[model samples]
Target: MCPRRARCFNTTGPCSPQHHYMLPPAQRLPEARELIEMDRYFVLHAPRQTGKTTPP
Candidate 1:
C-alpha cells in the first residue's frame, strides 16, 4: 500500500450501509444527495488514489 493512501483493507465484508451514521460530513466531502436529487448532469473527477472508484 502507498503511504499516501488510506488503509482500506476489510477483515470481513465491505462497509455496512449503517456506517453512514458514523461518517463526518467533511470526511465524505461534496456529498451524493444533491447529485441524485437535482437530476444534474456532471462528472465526478479526481486524481488517482483519491478513492474515486466505486465499490464493486
Candidate 2:
C-alpha cells in the first residue's frame, strides 16, 4: 500500500499528495443492505415506451 494511504485510512496526520483525490462511498455498505431487505414497494413508469410489466 502507498505509505500515505495507510496513514489516511486512520484519519491521522496529513497524508502525502498521493492520497488527495480519493472519495469515500456515499453510504457504508451495511446500511444499504438493510434498506434492500426492507423494500416493500416498487414502481415502473413509461411514456414514449408503450408497455410495462411486474413479476410475480
Report backbone clashes per prediction.
0, 0
Model 1 agreement with the true structure over 1-56: per-residue lDDT tens digits: 21343444333434433331123333565756576579876565876544343342
Query: Which residue pairs in model 2 clash with each other?
Result: none
lDDT of each: 0.44, 0.38
User: Which regions of candidate 1 are displaced past 4 Å?
Assistant: 1-31
The lDDT, on a scale of 0 to 1, for candidate 1 is: 0.44
lDDT of 2 by residue, 1-56 (tens): 44643433323334334553333323423354455579944444555322233111
Worst lDDT 10-window in candidate 2: 47-56
